[model samples]
Target: MNSTSFDLDPSYHILVTGGAGFIGSNLCEFLLNNGNSVTCLDNFATGKRENIAPLSSNSRFSLIEGDIRDLDTCQQACKDVDYVLHQAALGSVPRSINDPITSNDVNVSGFLNMLVAARDAKVKRFVYAASSSTYGDSKNMPKIEDIIGKPLSPYAITKYVNELYADIFNNTYGLETVGLRYFNVFGRKQDPNGAYAAVIPKFVLQLMEHTSPVINGDGSFSRDFTYIDNVIQMNIKAIVTDNKEAVNTVYNVAFGERTDLNQLVALLKEFLSEFDAKIADVNAKYGPTRQGDVPHSLASIDKAKKLLGYDPQFDIQKGLKQAVRWYWENLK
Candidate 1:
């Protein structure tokens, strides 16, 4: 069945916090397209209105310009909402390390507020964006959900704390919640011009401009770069799936594949150079490793597979093709 025809009974209303960011906007679009009423709550701090501009005319989609740090805002956003997908956060390790207080306020304090609101609203299930950075300092390939090391950055600590609070809510308040530990999610609509943009979009824009992209280290660091569609699918499965074993648990949302920075540059260049051959020779500059940066990170998505029936359709290369095409047509 198509997404619209899927059996997501309308008795449930959907609330998506941060619903104007790249991932959040996509989620809102998906939910609206599937015939569900979606209420988007975003402060427009990191999120942009243009991300949801196309949906402004949709009657089923409503926007609330609000901050999650405020308990009243969170409470109001959760009202009458059946499912909550909390994606708001102050991402970027460098940003977090520089201003741990703000990161903690948004990712931790705001997260708690959302949890309280969700509990008070009695939402069916609360799902939020957990980070792969939670696997900080693990030194393990294919990081699993159960095994996490000490957080290497403030952002990691905040995300790990989200899982902790979510678990506590489930145990103490009887709230059904699921945490998705996303690993390097990237694709269309991801901001490319920010000081803290993710590597894929940043590199694509630089290459398109015939400029060299910077590799923080020797280009050996790797990540399990996942596509946005897969992340969307995971969110859908997280709420709609009836697997009791999956509830009150965390799952690694990734492609189960790792690609190094050098390989990533090569792939993006290959895909983008088609738009302008000059992009092919876009050299990469090497710099000292970034602070709070992990050497290598991968994910074991087997638990998600067995529990939520998550089957990622797009790998890194495939996702890059679509993302590159989007940037070329839209940005250029």
Candidate 2:
């Protein structure tokens, strides 16, 4: 669990903006497990304390309940932190469609606040979560980081704006920053009960409950689903990496492969059936295509590999197996 022996210092203080959220909580555990000091700031909006329950006793970890939309809260979280991992945002295309203003306020304005606060705090580096949705209308086979299309949803616009503002901050204020454009991330502690829950978790939960999961559009719609552990590895490399070329650049965080919904469901059913045979017979219901949903997405990881020595340890099959196992043991 210690990275100190691997030449990483043990006393680095890292601040995670949405530390109680699924991805944020995972990063917190990774940082703390590697012998780094961590401060988690969350408003409990979408994030939950249960996500961080396992780390409650870690002396190297601290928690602050606050909103990033408030500049003061952002400032407080940045104080004395060596690195900033900004993960707080109201995410979900449908949620954004229902309430665009709030999504922009949290995802865009709050992101700007974090950037300014990190700049003022003089943190070593600021790494924020961007999204694959930034590649909105592009029809390219493998989505490269440099090439992007117009946003299809308000949520996508907000995330794309984060990268723009991060670039501006770096150029205008001299604050070093990196934006990680994460593809569909799935893993343990991902909440599956919400109306705006991501597909992987929601489908897993539905299968567990003996309910049919809805597949919007034809089963041909595809995505490059990344694993939580790979994401944690990217964040760590972003903060601690000595590669100057990697800093201040946006990298696509994905497995570099795509899987269609039908394939995804088949894989999920295959894995879950090991726990309960009845699930293998459970078929998904097809519905009208979702609003603001893209038909396909696949990231080209060549840029990340060339710049950051990026390497993904889990592909969709490997990740799905681990994720389904977690849901079976924890959820049911």
Candidate 3:
């Protein structure tokens, strides 16, 4: 059940590293709603103020405005925390291509700092956000965790390095870890105004403004468009699962289906047209494929289903409707 509530003991303290970003903010809110003590570490680099503004009033929630690149900051945030849900990172392939050094520093070195901090603190488990981009250059239909190709971008390499580092810490230091290789996760609060904005939210914003959304390649490129609630479910289960086999391993977190850019844009128009009929006329433009883009992506998610009891409740249709309504009510 993706009801935003879990029946676990709420006395534990959890830390969400990218606490003010879109996905991270959702996790923080969900964790706090379930009565866990949460410490949010964010540098406000890519994270937003409005995302976490509502959660600031909760007394049990703590905020640390610092960078993960600093070991001291990592140590400070890990203090007395029982579990660490590490989500902080520089998250765009194009941006990484432009500045790979920064990406490596934040994603690789910063990840190392978090792992060290979690290890030192002796947290029960360390759950971090991994990416499906790590499956670069692979032509697999439903990506399995064990099968991957050479990384196609600097961002992808950094994420792959995260899995490597997690494994090392687990094997070398007895640190318990779980990695959820998220597909194209989207939902409310996913910012639509950045050079590296995700396709769905960016298209929603464009259609709402009567501007054309651009497809990087042909309309055929597809993705395993996952919903935020499902992702939150995966994260929570990863944190609380009693299955020993689930620890120190990675799992695909997705809806087990794919949607092409054409279908995605059409659906956006159909839904937004309900609010403003004129949006139905707004079309999407085609452009050259992105440098590190893949033609198609769909995750098996069988491992997560078998291990964490993950049953995603939102497919693209259902999740898109909810997200469109949210944009109309809150941000439009």
Candidate 4:
């Protein structure tokens, strides 16, 4: 989880929207550890309180129980903030398919609200969590920043809309922005309880509970499974960079490698079985391919490397091993 390759000023006052969630909380902790002042804004929709409970005692850490859907709350949270890591949004393609209205209200409209607030507050940079799903319907083996296809799902539509709005905000208002189109990010503090839980953590938890985890689409679908540490590194890089070319553009945050669901299941089982031998016997069940899911997703991180000096520290096997250990110690 070390990003010793880069550093930021200790006196910076940063705000992280959805700071109680998985990626956001990790960012908050990393910033706080590096002696920065941080204000966390979360509505508790998907963010868990337990994630931030440990940081409550830190003198530089402040919490604002708020939502990005509300402009005033966003404005208040943005006040005096040097940088804004905007991670507030309703995620999950299936959830968006089930309730596109709420997803739109949060991912798109809420994003607009945050942009306006950051603009008015004059935050130095607004780095937001974009999605790899924006590359939907493209047959590109390795997703590039410039080339993209039509969005396939409501969730993808919302994330693509966020990028559009961010671009407009930057061009129209002169606000600085960086959008990180995150691949399948997973790691510690990631919730494995919900119906929309990510594959890695979900499968780990199911195996720990001695239940067979189901793999969708015969376990052939692949994704660029990035670790949360790499995502944190990108966010830090996004905000701290003095390179003018890096600003107001999007970069894919990933390890630049793809892992299929079958390989993913095998890795999860292999790591989790170290704690309990019974997990080794639990076979995976095959299910239908999910809607709005692309067959394979791999990222061409060349843009990230060229612009931001983005270097990912962990690969899939290393990330999955660390994540499995965290689940066994904390949740299991």
What lDDT score belongs to each candidate, Candidate 1 first? Answer: 0.92, 0.91, 0.93, 0.93
CA shift of 271, model 2, Å: 0.5
lDDT of 1 by residue, 161-222 (tens): 99999999999999999999999999889999888999988988888888899999999999
In candidate 2, list every pair of residues with a backbone clash. none
How do all models score by TM-score? 0.98, 0.97, 0.98, 0.99
The number of clashing residue pairs in each candidate reads: 0, 0, 0, 0
Off by over 4 Å in 4: none
Residue 215's lDDT within candidate 4 is 90
27-110 per-residue lDDT for model 2 (tens digits): 898888888899999999999899998897999999999998999999999999999999999989999999999999999989
Q: Once model 3 is optimally superposed onto the true structure by TM-score, how far is the C-alpha of residue 178 displaced, in angstroms?
A: 0.3
> In candidate 4, which residue pairs clash?
none
Model 1, stretches more than 4 Å misplaced? 1-7
Residue 103 lDDT in model 3?
98
**Sort order, lDDT high to low:** 3, 4, 1, 2
lDDT of 3 by residue, 19-80 (tens): 99989999999888888999999999999989999999999999999999999999999999
- Model 2 has an lDDT value of 0.91
